[model samples]
Target chain A: MIIDVHVHTRLGPDPHGFAYLLDQAAELDVTLCVNSLSPKDGTGMPESPTEDEIRRCNDWTAELAAAHPERIIPMWYLNPAHEDFACRELEERLAAHAGLQGVKLWVAVRCNDPRLDPIMRLCAEHKLPVLQHTWFKVTGNLPGESTPMDLRELALRHPDVSFFWGHCGGDYEYGAKCARGLPNVYMDLGGGEAMNGYVDLLVEHETADHIVFGSDAPGRSLISQLAKVYGADLSDEEREKILHRNAQALFDQQKPANGAAS
Target chain B: MIDANAYLGNWPFRKLRYTTHIALLDKMDALGIEKAVVSSLENVFYKDQLAGNRRLHSEVHPHADRLLPAFTINPTFPGWEEDLDVCVQEFGMRVIRLHPNYHQYGLDSAAGSAVLDAARAHNFVVILATGLEDTRHHHPLVKVPDVPAEQVAAAVSAYADVQFLVAAANFSGVSAVWTEAAHTANVHFEISRVQGPVGDIEKLCGTVGADRVLLGTNLPLHVPEAATLAIEHAKITAAERRMIVQENATRLFGLG
Candidate 1:
């Protein structure tokens, strides 16, 4: 079975909604591992969601994961742009959701910005794997969206922390080059319309161990993202690492029982 | 399954994994893809685009039965009728693709209207792409805009007699595009850009009806297995799956 590391809440509308997401994962025999709690819509929050909106989205995500602990793995989303309240927010959420395993950084600010330093230090202290939304768009980027290169810099700065580089920055050719030889970064397979060398190129540069599977589902496709791995004609060992092993290893590092933070 | 939206030639910005027909055939054979309706990437950049069509003929003719070739024309070009005649008469092409974004003209332009008239007269399946690549990641200097879904919807309604194959259909704000055209029987969509299991593919099938959806991978550019698995694993019925995978394409392309 495959583990999807990059799913969002409220994938789409149906009578079932989130229930449908879990049921479909069950039907497809996929494990719904990690989620970026945006809202009912699969698209993430407005680049910088209001503090109250952020609190509400995270609360909803925790409840959804709690209902299906066997299937769902929840990530704590942080918007460092709320620089004044961001650190306090993380502490309060962590105290509340003891088992949250990962950290989600959306496009509100670049990962390397000084604004995120306190957040990064807190994650490093907690051993949380940060899944940052990084894309290099040609048309343009969001006000402060990070790119693979930005993540690469952040990875070098925080060597002990694990980073799931979301969508490999869209253009896999450039993304692969940035990820090559970076042991801390794991290329996320999600969101973008993948091409012929999406997996092979990344594996050639980063190897299968450094690459993980993520279905930006509800907004994207689960099977389609899974097929990016399964259809790569990889060996069993390579497939296993991407399908579940790498993600499981990353998740295991989180200090689940030690959620206390001032 | 038949891959209805594969491409050949250089991408200009980046090198493709497969740029030749031999590689495509080997891939199709391995994946059990019987036939693929293909267009040219090289043509989109060319001034005449007819050269790219001629190049495609040379490359695909050897495996004609399996590689169903489609010709592209810049309908805005003067006397495009002669070019269409060549593609139809000399090349025996059955599909005429348009890249108004690459060709730099509005789909509602007078020249665009003339092409629609030609499409009605020629009775060839007209394949228009919502986009070949995400404009967000396109070369910043190129400044290519996507063919808005509403524009495609408008054409589908106006050219009621011509078969419109919307390739790489954009799912973002799709209602404005596909839902508008859903009422028409002449419009069909290729799933090169659509995904499933909560990606709302079933909703698309429900709205447009299954018979109007065809399987497309945008291959040598996208994963063939991904396209096949999307329908196989979609929530729609097996019969809907069957229609999406091959039957719809077989009927649209007139494959015997």
Candidate 2:
């Protein structure tokens, strides 16, 4: 079962909107996609998604999955800045959608921001893996986007909650090194040049189990991302783990009804 | 195919275990890279670029039939003209590489002008390196600033006689530069750093034309095969693909 863990929907300010993405996902054979909603532009410091918007976005994702039970898996998007709202949203979404397996965070806010602690604790309590938008501070396009160093510290602080740091730190070597000792921290190979011989680095220097495949779709095409991994020199077993097994294992713990391995 | 911007030495951050020259050649051969204009990483990083360039020239000069040498020159250094002369006359170098940001000098500086003058006098093709990766991904303290497109354009405009090749220009920057400098016939853009869908190259070529684009792979950092595949599968006509992949670089660098 192929799962694309990183996808943005237009429930936010994206011009393409949701229906366009749903059609694209269906055509791409994406069995399960974790949809994320971005905040409106100019929503300065602590860019928070409105509670009503979050509910509507998650409902749309849940409905898509319900309509095609075998194809889609909804992930709850949470803005840690809205602490109480985040916890309430997670609780309500989980109760409403039995297939909701995990949560997603943009991590554009400060890594050490105390507001995220309660949400992290709640995710830990629910046994839900959190996919956080992460990169090295050097490569982060936004000023406050969480860096690997920040995520590393967060992973150390919350060792029980699984953290999938997206973009493999944007630069492969440094990101892999930053994530090395943090067992709770995994990396999503998403953007940037598809460097050859990177898989060997992951196997020799990083934990193979800690790596997952997430194509930052819409921004990048699915074919390009898939080709990057497919073209890499990896063993079938390692490829299997990176492509789906690792993600499946992460979601399996949450026990989303249809998320169970086929 | 002649690769205009190929490297023969180690990148400190490369994931693959450093392979011998023969191993690198075998890999390049499999990817159909027949002739590659090579440089050394030490030349790009270390204080003494000549020492590394000398070692690289010695290694590749013997097999000059397949491996053409491009000596790296840090314009910021003292006695750069002497080194440039030695690289061209003594080592038979046809191409000169500039790492303005790494060497701590602006590409538009007085020293940079001297280097360009010497390159023109010797008929050496000049390759301006923008960056190897997104700067935000570099070591926390070790900052490698991008060679700004404006500075590159200024340099290209300043030296109309000498041919200038810009490596690592992004898709948007390439288009912007060409729009203003389209009449600057000496300017050429390398394809390895500018990425998009396969058809993206065709669109770029339509705007800039095929002659101004050359094939380059930031090898050991990026996979050479991906760059080669992009050129190989480009949607343009076969003649245009040949011009981008092999003919243009061959003519620019005089690599037969």
Candidate 3:
């Protein structure tokens, strides 16, 4: 089964929001792990999401996932800065909607920041996978931006939790190398230029089992993103692991050990 | 559609194992790309661009039927004008690509203007590679920024008689120079690194007439099939698709 681990409903109210994503997902023939996004302007992401904004985004995600249980899988987006509030909301939301399969951490706090410890702890308890936003900026690693190394440190800190590094650390080559032997760390092929040789490098240097397919949809096209892996020179076995097997295995592990969510 | 932006030779930063002209053509053939305008990656990093262009001419010679040479010329280098003449006169290369970001030359400098003039004089199609790789993914030790779009637009406006193709201008980069690209008649864009929603090709076609866009994959650096799929999946009329994928470039380069 082809699965896209990264997708969003919409940041704002558009009559054609979830409908648009569903239609595209059908055309692309992949199950989507849909997340919520705060309202955004043309420039980029919305200013740090407010408490109400976070709640609304999570609501939208749950509604869509519940509507298409077979196709749409919900992943919660949290702002770790609002530590107590975020933790409260995640508990309330997950209890309310049992369909949430993962957690998405944006640039609200560095992956290594202690602020994320609570969220990571919660994920570890729930056995939920974490997809953290990462970008390898030219200006050097900024405060909020999560590099692959930062993710490596975090993944090492929480060995019980599974962390999917987003955008393959933006640059990918270094990201793949950093993720090599970290059993808990997985790489998602998302965002940025689909640099040539990057995917091959990942498969050769980093095990294909460690890489997952993610299309940062609505902002980018699925075909273009899929082409990054589909067009790469990889074996059928390696391609299968990246396209679905690995992601399925990750989700299959989310059994909420000890009835953690309840 | 003929790809207006392609490359031969190795890039020092990455192991693009498929760097030979033959490998490029075989890959292009697999993707159904009949022809492509090619250049050498050596030109991107080498200080002696003359030698790089010469190497490109020789490498592309065997497969001249499928690969058309786009020689790189750094205007700031001494004897660059003579090198340009050799690129056109000796090699008969019709397209001249400039890497101001890699070569460290201002697009608006006097030497830059002279290079544009020489291309115009020889009727060469000019491809200003706005960027080769995304800045966020550049090799740490040698990070190269994209050639400023503003400078490219200014140059395009300054030389109306010369046709300028902007290669590797992603969605943001295109938006940054939208006003200038819209007003300037001679400026065209190559859709190699343009990232947007599903109907992005159509969106760009509407913004800058379809005639102003060309098919480019930046192959050996990108997936050629991916570039083609983007065009094939875009919501556009057959005529508009024809213009973007082939006719515009064919006419611009006098491919006939």
Candidate 4:
């Protein structure tokens, strides 16, 4: 089965959003892992959310997972800068909810930041996979924006936790290299700011099992994102691993420890 | 469905093993792209624009059944008129693409105007290569900004008699040129990189007329089925989908 390891729900509290997303994914014959980051706050300039807003986002995802036990999975979208709240929320939610699949980190803090240490430790205890947003080829060497190297640094520090490099390093050629020797760092192929041969290059350098398929949908085309995997010249077995098996293995390995549903 | 935009040749930044015209054809067949209007990377990279045009025409001639040549014409280049004539008169090329950003000329410049005038006289469809890749993720050594929307609007306004297609434009690029795209009847947009939301195609069509949007995949640099499948699965009526996939491009390119 094709499991999309990355997707975002419609921003804000629209009760109908998750249902709509599930329906759309059904058309492609794939299940979804919806990151509960509101489009309004998840992207653009990062805004600090109140504790209530954070709870609301996580709670919304938890509820969606409850509704679709078999079709949809939830990833905890946490602002690592709010370490205490993030840690508390993960503990609270994962304790009660077994379907919460992984943790998603965006530009809240660089993947290499020491501030992320506590959150990383917490995820390690729970054995939750970490998906960190990464990009390159943009203006302004912004302080908090994580690069492939930054992600590599963090993955090196914590060999136990698997890191999904979002956007495949977002136009950075070195993304595949970051995963070359690191068994824990896998790449999630997504992003429009990509070049041809990007996926092919990744497969060549890192092998296919270390990569996962993500659409970054609503903001991107699911068909297009899948093409990044399907269009690549990989064996059926390799493609299957990237499309579903790798993710299934990662999430499943953690399930017995964290008690998430298979 | 016609792919309004596609490409052949090497991208300096990334390796695309399928850079040959024949390789593009294999890809086209696999993706179910009936016809593709293509430009050459040589046109954007080569200093001498005419040489690039000749190379593109020569390369695409054998595969004329599925591939249609869209020559690159930089107005600022010397002997541009002759090159335009060669593309039009000699090669019978109907489509001409301009790289305003790469050519280092504004759309409103004398050079730009002269090319537009020649294109008008010769009855050529003009495709403004507004963007090659997203500006945010461009290589650090070579930063190519997208052609500003205001410039596109100005050109569209100036050349009201000419049919203009904005190529490789994203949503922001569309917004920048939305007024011209909506107001100017001759102005059209190609969706090679316009992605957002679930029903973004319907949203764009709702904002602009469905008639103005054309199918583009930015192929070789992008996966062709990405756009083709996206269009096929869009939440629009059959008629609307048909227009975007084939009818609109067929009519615009005079591929009757």
Candidate 5:
């Protein structure tokens, strides 16, 4: 019942890096992958993806999930900059695909921006969780990128919406401290940074109640990232909460009863 | 598996746990790693690198069956040869780890040549640990960049006889530093740093040949399981997996 809450498929047709990830998940007894979209050349997301690009990437993600059936769960990718389009396309994508579970926010816009308000509002309406890609890079970050401090501000604002902070911010010790006391924010252990001791910080500060499994796959080694949790010093109860329970609760919350119309 | 890269002692940036030699071996034991070739983390920061080496030998010697200690040689410092001798002749350490970036010396410095000469003279396995953690996440004061792979490649080309292990380098390092083009065998890339999309140690094995990729967990600073599980999950052959998991490291470090 392991669910890798953070995973990526190629943008268009899936030429490189997907099969091995799928096979690794299957072999590892990982029941499902909550997959987002990225590029085929191993490059990351565009800073500002156009509306059509978002739709195209989401379409490809849905197709990968459909082709794989229960093994894949598509996470809708939305650039909050496309707020009106995001609110519109989110419902459209939800109505079209039933298993579509969460919204993935990459670096196109800072998670704390007012532009994200509408998307956050819509997610709260739908009870959907948002996985925001975050890093506190010593190198200059991208223009619209959100640091853990910024994410904390967002989490403080949107108390009802569950936000899975991706990569737990690169310097997770600092990031976890920043994320401390925010109950609605769950740190996704997905950064391929693979450094030690951050997980313990998450446990001490955020608690296992706020931890979830993710592998930042294809770009990072799935097992390496997976081992971030598997290799950490945690109790079985805490381990289960991180590996599946916490994520399942988030996925379970995304069920919209109104037939998915905007 | 022989985790050819790991550390013992404190890091100034992060409050590290599980860093004692016993904790490290226990971690390796839990991860099924037979031995770990470890260096002193404090050595990278300490100006008197020999003191760090002395601490490492003191910490690891009692657990020599499971822990193998390596000396951190700051080639820029005076009396480095004396320190190297004390570590080898007294502490009985066979591995030498160099931190050119942290120590602020070029890989082509006379100090570098002198260390290589000592390495060749002593038949020691030299490790170049350039990437400790991603520099982007360094402590505000400790923003050290990696020694460029080209520079290391040139050094590798220059000293064909020294068995070198490039620790914590990236996949581009595999391409630029030790690729099929080099057709070189004297150097090996530690696995903890070789990351990317489409990981199947097969891709690396296909490119560099299996003999050149060594398993190193960068333990205490990282998790040992991540390195071990990477080899377990790769789409490589059993023989290739064996080579990556332990064989390459065992042969490189003479850990028969």
Candidate 6:
């Protein structure tokens, strides 16, 4: 089954609404998609979404998941800067929606900001996986975006929490290098730039297990981006892991079969 | 079926994805690509135009029937004339690729004009590669400065008698350059870099005619399936698709 993890719904700034996105995904034969909330910072915190807005977005996702059932898996977007509000909303969403898999954070906040500790602690307590938007300082396009070094610091800070670095080996080769020994951290291959030697990089570095497939849909086409990975020279087993198994395994670990919260 | 713009070898900052030649070829072959005019990643990084060119030529030249070598020449190199001569004479490179931003030279400069002349003199087809990735989404420090369309227009005007291929250029860039150059009979636009829901080749062909658009897969860097699908799914007639895919390139590059 083709699953795209990095998907955006009309819950935020996208001009294209949720219905349009769903229709496009369905047309593309996407069985499963992780619909993430686009962050909003009315407070002028650069890329962070407001607390009330985040709650509303999560509520909308929960409603949508209820309607679609197995098709859509809502991934909560949280800004740790909102401290207590973030934990409250996370707990509220977890209690409200059993289908919700994990949390998505745009670490565009700042490299290793201490305020994020509470948010990571909450995820650790709930056993929820966190996907951070990561890149290298030099190669990353965004001026204020967090680098792989920042992600390494964040991973080291919260060793028990499962952190998935979004964009995988994007432009920064150092992210792959830093993620080699860190098992708790996984990388999503999508967005920004395409790396020249991605498959061999994963194999030689022995970080194949940490790599997962994600297409920053809308910004890119689901079919075309998936084709890049599908057409790559990887073993069937390795392709399966990157395509679906790894994501399923990560999500399953966070929410076990018993329907327990943690 | 040779793609004029393809890259092998390693791009720094990322792990070497496709290491061996067979590994790269097998992937390209799956996409229906028969032969590719490829350059080494080392040439892109160390700026050692000839060494990287020779390394690529030596590896792929033995299998020249399958892999055609296109030497990447850095106009910034002090001994660029000697390098260009060696590439054409020793390796039989008929095509040369230029990375303006990567090599830190303006295509409008006097030196760049000389490089163009040298390429024309050797009967080599010049391919100007615009941007590898979208600048908005690129690494902040790895700035992909636009390959000035006016400079390309000026070059086309300067050498109306010679033919050139522009790879990774957008629709607007193609249109602007072609319009200014007036006589675009000698220019061919490589379609891998320009993408949209609508087929760019069909649209461009309607404007610039089918003969000016050719099939190019920035393979390894880009997936060929979508581009291939775009050409296949275009609104143009089968004859036109054939022209864009094979006939146009065959005629322009003298591949037949």
- After the best TM-score superposition of candidate 3, give how far the Cα of residue B208 lies from its true spot, in angstroms: 1.5
* Model 2 lDDT per residue over A97-119, tens place: 66646777775466657778998
RMSD of each: 3.0, 4.5, 2.9, 2.6, 2.7, 5.3
Assess each model's interface with DockQ, reporting 2 decimals per model: 0.57, 0.24, 0.55, 0.59, 0.72, 0.24
lDDT of 3 by residue, B1-256 (tens): 6998999888887788568887887888788788899998888888788898888888888778778899998888888888877877789878999888888888788878888888888888899999887787777788888888788878887778888888998866776676764357878888889855545676688888788888899988887666788888776889988998889988888776
Please list the residue runs of candidate 5 whose C-alpha ends up more than 4 Å from where it truly belongs after superposition.
Answer: A11-14, A31-44, A256-262, B180-183, B195-198
Docking class of 5: medium
Clashing pairs in 4: A11-A39, A218-B197
lDDT score of residue A15 within candidate 1: 30
Tens-place lDDT per residue, model 6, A51-130, is 76677666666666777766677778777778888888887777777664678777547548887898888778777778
Please, what are the lDDT tens digits per residue for candidate 4 over residues B1-256?
Answer: 7999988888877767568888887777777778989988867878888787788888888878778888998888788887777777778989889999999899888888888998898788999989887776667777889899999988888788899889988876876798654348788888878754556676688887789999998877776656776687778888898899899999989886
Q: Model 3: which docking level applies?
A: medium
Residues B1-256, model 5: lDDT tens digits: 7888999999887777678887877777777888888899998889999889888888888888888888899989989888888988899878999999999988888888888888889988889887787788887777899998877887887888888898988776676786432537688888786655556476778878888888888877776667787788777788888888788888888886
Q: In candidate 2 chain A, what residue range of length 10 has the lowest lDDT sum?
A: A38-47
Q: Evaluated against the true chain A, what TM-score does chain A of model 2 have?
A: 0.83
Model 1 over residues A67-94: C-alpha lDDT tens digits?
8777777677788889868888777766
TM-score of chain B of each: 0.94, 0.93, 0.95, 0.95, 0.95, 0.93
Candidate 1's residue-wise lDDT over B193-215, tens digit each?
76654645687887778898888
True contacts kept of 3: 0.57
Off by over 4 Å in 6: A10-24, A31-46, A52-70, A91-98, A125-127, A139-144, A203-207, A231-233, A253-262, B7-31, B40-64, B76-93, B117-124, B131-162, B168-248
Reference contacts recovered by each candidate, as fractions?
A: 0.72, 0.28, 0.57, 0.58, 0.76, 0.23
Q: How accurate is candidate 3 locally (lDDT)?
A: 0.80
Model number with the top TM-score: 5
lDDT of 2 by residue, B90-119 (tens): 898888888888887886788777788888
The segments of candidate 1 whose C-alpha lies over 4 angstroms from its true place after superposition are A11-17, A36-44, A98-100, A255-262, B196-199
